[model samples]
Target: MDDVKQNVQKVPKRKGLSNKGQENFWGYVFIMPNLIGFTVFTLFGIVFSLIMAFTNWNLMKGLDKVQFVGLDNFRSMIGDAYLSASLRNNLILLIVVPITLFLAAILAVVMNRNVYWKSGARALYFLPYITNTVAVSTVWQALLHQTKGPINSLIARIFNLPMKQTPGWLSSSKWVLPALIIILIWQALGYDILMYSSALQSIPADYFEAAEIDGANAIQRFFYITVPLLSPMTFLLMILGVIGSLQMWSFVQLVTKGGPGTASYTIGLYIYRSGFQTYRTGYACALSWLLCAFILVLTLIQWNGQKRFSID
Candidate 1:
């Protein structure tokens, strides 16, 4: 009876599946749901949009009414005044990437040193990035008010100038883009700083020590050793910043709605207006493809250029 019980306990292995094969099979099983979801939603949507770009399809009209109009939507883009203005604005906004990265680099250097309330300072800076976009825009809207806003009020008091002489931030086309740029920079600074600070920690102290022993000043050490080492992070932030700036629409939509004669219109805002407001689905799809192409080209350029500057 004991021998029979022991033999029964020795179960046979599977006929074909090895341990690794079993693991891979189970892994695929676990991921099957997500894979299906991506296929049904993301992948399908992408392919569908690409096809729709070549056809005149109005949402209001039935699917059977989709008219084939190859290249017409693409051609229409050349004469689109709104698209031109929005693209120009997006190009202008690209300046935010470099400026924000520069400031973040400087601040990261300062914070990496012995500083007061370091954790609190970092949290305060990061707060804006994690905050709700609508809420942030709302707060900025009030702060940037032409007359009653604290910013203009402070300027008026500091310069002892009348309110009329103070710059109209959101209200005037001349200052709207600049105001938006300032807000973008402030919002993005914290994330960049965090990334920089983390990168700074990884750098060996020996590098700085050697530089110090060699009689190198703070700025010289920063430029020579620090800058080169941090080049990879800089490249990463530059790519992300440029992409974010180009796709920026929420702030413009919430604050100015591309008003003051499309002074602050961005490609994203134009796309939204075309698709939702005007219901020009085909044209919107075409425009989005163009934007995608632009981003891809720019990213490729940056990727190729990074070899020249990146340390690793």
Candidate 2:
């Protein structure tokens, strides 16, 4: 009777194992399409681009004409004056990321409080984020026109100065970058506010109630409880903001076109012009890899620092 009982238990165990195996097979089947697509489209392209970075192959040349000129492209980047200018422009724009994030956080905090038409207010703030980039750029272009733009007109009237004396925001090399930064900050503010609002909402109300009970004022509660708990989201936004700022191109392209003598040239614009405009595919690939490395290093730095402030 005991032997028969043991045999019955072994049969159920074998059946359970078979069921688990079948489930695993089906799970793999379900994900196979996405896996294949990613490998073909993204992974293959990245590997090919990395290989191209070491070669001297313009698009006009056949694959058979590709020559291995290892490190030459990389060395050229060191002395490339345009590359230096692009890096400088990107670094200047990096200031916008932090400022926008800070302002967004404040807006989120204010919006989180009980207010009339809060939903509508939030939507209004986020409108710029969803609006078409070209349309937004064009509107701003009109608004920032050197002579006829409303912004310049307002400034000229306020200061009692000639319209010509008013700053040439989009036209002047000195002012173009700052103008771009302002527009970018305005455009990005809505999304950042939304992200921060979501993060704020996720915090438990009980935490705030508890802090209040312990004699903490609103300001104290915000800095001590809210900020700490929001650190994870803050860190995430910082990383993403840095990455996005580094790759910023469209605004510069549509607004300034890296113009007034390439003063607004960013790495992204440089890479695009090199590959598509100049047909220097190899050099463009090299520039792209350098950008990838720069982003990777910065991301790793932020990741490492997260442990100090992130909740988990």
Model 1 Cα lDDT, one tens digit per residue, 1-312? 999867755645465666567778889999999999999999998998999999887877788999889999999999788999998889988998999899999999989987999989999999999987898889998998989999999999999999998988988989988998999888999999999999999999999999999999999999999888999899999998888787887778987899788899988998888888888888888888998998999999999899765644
Instruction: For candidate 2, write residues 185-219 as lDDT tens digits.
Output: 98899999999999999998899899899999989
Displacement of residue 293 (Cα, Å) in model 1 is 0.6
CA error at residue 190 for candidate 1, angstroms: 0.5
Clashing pairs for model 1 are none
lDDT of every model, 2 decimals: 0.89, 0.89
Please count the clashing residue pairs in each candidate, in the order shown: 0, 0
Residue 266 CA error for candidate 1 (Å)? 0.8
RMSD of each: 4.7, 4.3
Candidate 2: where are CA atoms >4 Å away? 1-25, 213-215, 310-312
Error of 2 at 289 (Å): 0.6
lDDT of 2: 0.89
